[model samples]
Target: MARTLKEATLTTRNARAKLGEGLHWRGIDADTHLGYRKGKRGGVWLVRWRVAEGHYHRDKLGAADDAITEGTLDFNAAVRAARERVEAVRREERAKADGVVHSVRSAVLAYSEMRDARLRERTGSEALRTASSSALERYVTGRVAGGNMEAREAAPIADVPLHDLTEAQLSEWRDALPPTLKASTRRHISADLRAALNMAYRLHRTKLPASFPMTVTEGLHISRKASAEAGEATARENQILPDSKIGEIITAARDVDAAGSWGGDLYRMIIVLAATGARFSQVARLTVRDVQADRSRLMVPASRKGQGSKPEATPVPVGADVLAALAPAIRGRAGGDLLLTRPKMMREPGQLKWVAVGQRPWGMAARLVEPWAEIRKAANLADDVVPYALRHSSIVRGIRAGLPLRLVAALHDTSIAMIERHYGRWIADGLDDLAAAAVVPLVPA
Candidate 1:
């Protein structure tokens, strides 16, 4: 039952006495503040009640003259409002905590409030989120930051609250991704956004929407197996360059004289790729220390996927031409240095100086290759033949030259199974070479 004004006064007086001056206990009707007020007639008990923390203030409800008299202040009405306000506050707190639907902007603010470290720990700190963020920065930010659901934006669903994301909404956004995105690339975006949302919910459990949803099937219908096959076909087609064309490219590169050295770095880099069968990024990221001059080995410290983990440097030996080509770059190898890399591109612009031993700039290289491609096109070469074709040609040459599968695998720093799967068709008929190299007893020694 609600207290009467007289009852509330008595309660306030007792609470004030216990708590001392200036402190008051909360009651249904008001929060009473107690103190002594200096008056013309000396001092008197000054009592006041604040109906709400900042919303309402009442001076003890009744005047000092009426304090000992009627003390009428509609105490019941005040109590009811206070009770309703308290319940409303409780509801808001519960809704926020329970992950009820919030505006996208509000949800974003809540997500940003969590510390990165805390969120990572709670979500197990998967590296994919970092990669996803990179893709987002590249594609999503510029378009969406302008506050438009522009059709050109990749993954428009990211603009919606993660918790409120539904399959239909995801589908709409999926349809909005660039038409050029391969199924694999689309899948990657889906997985990336999923990881981000999942992490948000896990780390900020109390603040996320209670029923967040996602679906990878929204935009594309290509199966993972089909995508893998397409990728494999692409890889195989890339590696099937003619030996005659390879000789022509070599000739084109060698035509550059030492006085100019226009094609020197470009030529040598291509030779290394062919001989080493290293991924373009792998070759680009190589530090001086990664090369073993004495052993003619190309060491890959880590793949793009396995970076920040332990370095997995695999050593693959190269032929003399490649050794000679690379010799210029490795001329004065000091202890502990990068053999090759495009660190200039990796580092933030304006933060580092350009160095010869630094990493290769992939974009710049690709642009440079345009003229090369035009030259090849003039020669009626296949359009798919690229710098990576050197790597593939080297593998094919190794198999054709009667190298053992194990040795080929070692030279390429890949599995025997991979060598067989990729180049076995070209080498399968050459088992006679394998037989010739097989252990045959010359004598019973």
Candidate 2:
């Protein structure tokens, strides 16, 4: 039902008095209404307009009282505001239906919200969240921040309209990144931006300009050349420790353990990592139950890297020495107990005796690489030597020991192509043995 006001009666206070809470007076059309409501601040004028079929939108025009800082709305002003609002609503509805005029910020935010919801529902790894968030923070939000740091300032293109965004503008922004950022990092950030735009296009079903360039491939290629010229494009090689160096590191770890400054568990962890070639994350999450009774193999649980769409357990074969090294930590522990646990400071007791705490569900594990710095320094290893070096050392040693390429890849949960790419030369060093055993000189015979 529509309530229409007579133009003659609207000029009196009597007509104004009739406009009470939940009362609406019809304006030029049935779909548009000038309404009144009693609120905490005396009275408020509201305009309700139907932008589409059965879809009504409302907006507060102003307060009825002058004392309300928002300003007083007389009948004429209210009607004018209502008409304007109606026009605005129609424009917005049209834009939404036509998939035009959405800002880049709006689309990116929509994509981010959708991505976060999916991650939460699927229990996705933090790395995926980090990659997406990095793109949003660095480019969309215009913040020059990533790697778990606070956002400092906005990027140049942060506020640019999505439809108006151009490849030239993006190339300029990409070039402005800190020279210290690696080529790989630049490529990753670019890839993330492209992914966000693709997701936005798919999810919003919006018609982006055909000229819109989502990928920054050309810009990245140019940047890579620039980086090479600046000597910043060199690929980092993994540090592989020799047997003698490993022995020295182990000796230093044992010395540190004997001093009781840290626990013996640290050395055991190093031994296991060196022997099994498992990632730090996988090894850190190990429990007694993960180890097989035969002590020849251990099950590496599906982590972010190994776990794809469908996750399952991966079994890694271990040497006898690796089993012996892990024995001290797992001895007398329940099957479910963590293999590696770090002592924590629970409370300070009278300055002399500090209460020590063990493992809790959310407590810090001995997974960080910082603790190994001292050991590395003491062992006179390279400054760049990290915990992952042990895994590389294992892989290289296995290849040198004439382990089949496929077997080595299986052992390390990696691909044959990856092994060939990084450790191919080392793998080639052992090819002579294969030649000596399998082939004979045809010319001499």
Candidate 3:
């Protein structure tokens, strides 16, 4: 949907120079405006979208193609990028609409659109290292931004409206997904579907019929015990590292450092991971200011899952010893600097030596795979153990220390239901101490 009425003049550098220092506008498909801010030397391209009456938002798309420069955009390219921003805004509006969704298909579409938009907002231009949203959003976007694989896999039952949808119908849908899909894959998709339906009800409760969806109360979560027996569960016994094993792994990370493969990058990352029990994705995104060495806290970024932007950093208390470990990375760095960076490597012309130059962040999760493999071998860790094991190990420690599951979930930024499902078995192991407290009270302390 591109409309280039005034694009001919805006395309050339000579023509743009003549304009005054203000926004020059050209409509794109009647809904969006591809704008250029005229300047003496150079200017930026912008997109203005009016999603609904009386409400509009404008964002910088890139630089105007006045000179051959990075981030500069041509007239045609401006239209293309403008349309993407327009589509994203519209999808967000549709996803969180005040009205009820008529069908599961539409609900899924809305949720997918909302997540994809939010993912881009969350990661900005860094390229999604860890996508807050799932691949279903990609499928939905490719399929007319709504029609791709979501319709293919979750079809037939997707036509049922929320009020009309029953527990049996939802259960059947979950149970009947193709056998070719792995058990974990099936679980993830069902979890997504469950979220979509529940979101719809949560958003438009009053508008829905009195019955609403019965599935909303309990959700489509198949018993974790049942799934574990089926095998390939995401959270499993092997995922949890023991206290002694964690120390061994850290010691091994330091061993890897002697080779200069990771330097302080992996070492510091492991320290935060072990201390905070935060996600690898979260730890990788921390800035120097996020360190807060004085307060002895790591402000974890609140997820931008459903919304268009990051809400705020969640302050999780950490031991002062953890901050002491991070002292090298934090000392004298700018507040906005990345807490951990892989020093940039370069080879001068005609030189055989590759010299370490400046620095770069440990970006994508995939980037860690190679380094992790080497460290894993050094540590003699099991095949199933991974960076995520730090989180599991920490959660298990909290439970064993007699901290409530609800408290553990909050500390780790997850739901109590998740803690109960994955780690509840350990709760029983600690019941003796918990029961002992209750026994003396009843006998009159």
Q: Write the per-residue lDDT of candidate 1 for residues 47-154, one digit (tens) a residue.
A: 344444454443323222214324432334334444544444444464466655443333333433343343354334332223454454454433345555343443
Q: How close to the true structure is residue 444 of candidate 1, measured as C-alpha lDDT?
A: 67
Candidate that would win on TM-score: 2
Model 2 RMSD in angstroms: 14.8
* Model 3 stretches with alpha carbons more than 4 Å out: 1-173, 180-182, 194-225, 228-235, 257-260, 303-315, 341-364, 404-406, 433-445
- State the lDDT of candidate 3 residue by residue for 1-445, as single tens digits: 3333464257777888887787788777666777898777788899888766655689989887787756678878888999877765664455446654467767777776676665455444334523424544432222333534343243457666655566777777667666777777766777777777777877766545445556554557666566677765555687777878888887877777758655677787777888888887677778889977678788986643443454477788888877887889888889887787776778999999887877776655666677778778988888667788889888888888898777787778777777877776777777766887677445655
Tell me, what's the RMSD of every candidate? 16.9, 14.8, 21.4
Alpha-carbon runs more than 4 Å astray in model 1 = 1-156, 166-172, 175-222, 228-232, 236-238, 242-244, 256-263, 306-311, 333-337, 340-368, 374-380, 394-445
TM-score of 3: 0.57
> 240-350 in candidate 2: lDDT tens per residue?
778888888888887866664446676776776777787775676678888884958888765545223523556788778778877777788899887766545455655
lDDT of each: 0.52, 0.65, 0.71
- Poorest 10 consecutive residues by lDDT, candidate 3: 136-145
Task: For each candidate, give its TM-score against the true structure.
Answer: 0.50, 0.59, 0.57
